[model samples]
Target: MIIKKTSLVTETKDNMRGGNGAPVITHVIGGEILGNKGRLYSKIVMQPGDSIGYHQHVGEQEIYYFLSGEGMVKDNEETIKIYPGDVMITPDHGYHSIENTGTEELVFMALILNADA
Candidate 1:
């Protein structure tokens, strides 16, 4: 049995350089959950004036949860301001992106579930 309690806090600036100029830390990844048909990941410390590129999933759906700060979520035809504790989801074939619109950093988590499971 795998049983343990631990305190884990990660600083995005410590690792990962985004394609753009933003900093991100991946708290969980594709292989973290085994035997599962989906993936879970988290990106924190998104500074103001930064964003994640828009993209779509071929055979999956994604769920986003904003933990702190404020931001904007853009899709094919809309851009919505997002506040802390907001939960947004993307359909199987929808496209979306996220941007930090606040002065401080934005932290968000994403979960992707593949359809072919």
Candidate 2:
């Protein structure tokens, strides 16, 4: 199945997971398409100073692949700088958060998969 870019769903999340400013989220595919394998597959765009607050994953794992701009990620207990082409993986029971610190918008692809699947 081919999912067109125009058919993707986009929305702005305010203080997402307790972050700072609203971040734009574009859903590349929904859970229905993933079937029991994952819950999220999307593109995230965060303006300067925007963030997705630290949170722990219970039964799922999330992967973030940076596409452009700069940012910082609090991966578990480590605070690391993120740049284009950087990838972060938060496994089940791990904690992580991200913040955009660049002048341009931070763009990334996020995928969350069920740990049991």
Candidate 3:
């Protein structure tokens, strides 16, 4: 089965996960699609000045693949520059956050899955 782009659901949230500005979330799959399981597959768009707050993952892990634009990714206490084609992984028991520091929008694909599943 193929999921068309137009068929995908997109939602904009202000201060997502206690973040800074509103970010657009394009849900590709997961959640109810996974029977309320621990999984997330989505595209995230963060405009200038937008950000996702720092948070820790205990029972899960997340991977972020930058598709376009630039940003600063805060991994624990370190802030690293990120660009297109870059991939970052925050393992279980780790913390991470992202900020759009460029003039253009920061676009990325995020995949989250249960650590033990």
Candidate 4:
């Protein structure tokens, strides 16, 4: 099945996952569609200074693929700069967070999958 861009669900979140500022989240697919395979599949847009706070994944793993702009990611205790084409993975029980540090909007795709799947 194909999903239309106009039909995609979008929302702005404040202090998402404990981060700062509001970030736009466009769902590429809903949880129901993902079933037990995962919990999230979306495109995230963060303006300069916006962030997604540090958090840990218990039974799941998350992946982030940067599309544009620049950002910084705190992967466990290591802080790394992110740019277009960059990809980050947080394994189960791992901690990670991200912040938009560029002048333009930071765009990326995020996917979270159940560890058991």
lDDT for each residue of candidate 1 in 1-117, tens digit (9 for 90 to 100) = 342224333444522223244557565555356336786565566778777777877787778889888988886669999998899888788888777889988878877877555
Query: Which candidate tops TM-score?
Result: 2
Model 2 scores what on Cα lDDT? 0.96
**Whole-model lDDT values for every prediction:** 0.71, 0.96, 0.91, 0.96
Judge candidate 3 at residue 73 and give its lDDT. Answer: 95
Instruction: Give per-residue CA lDDT, model 2, range 1-117, as digits (tens).
Output: 888888889999999999999999999987999889998999999999999999999999999999999999999999999999999999999999999999999999999999987
Q: Could you tell me the C-alpha RMSD of candidate 2 in Å? A: 0.7
Residue pairs in clash, model 4: none
Estimate the Cα RMSD of every predicted model relative to the unseen true structure.
3.8, 0.7, 1.6, 0.8
In model 3, where is the ten-residue run with the lowest total lDDT?
30-39
lDDT of 4 by residue, 30-70 (tens): 67899999989999999999999999999999999999999
Query: What ordering of candidates by TM-score runs from best to worst?
Result: 2, 4, 3, 1
Which stretches in model 2 have alpha-carbon errors above 4 Å?
none
Clashes of each: 0, 0, 0, 0
Candidate 2 or 3, higher lDDT?
Answer: 2
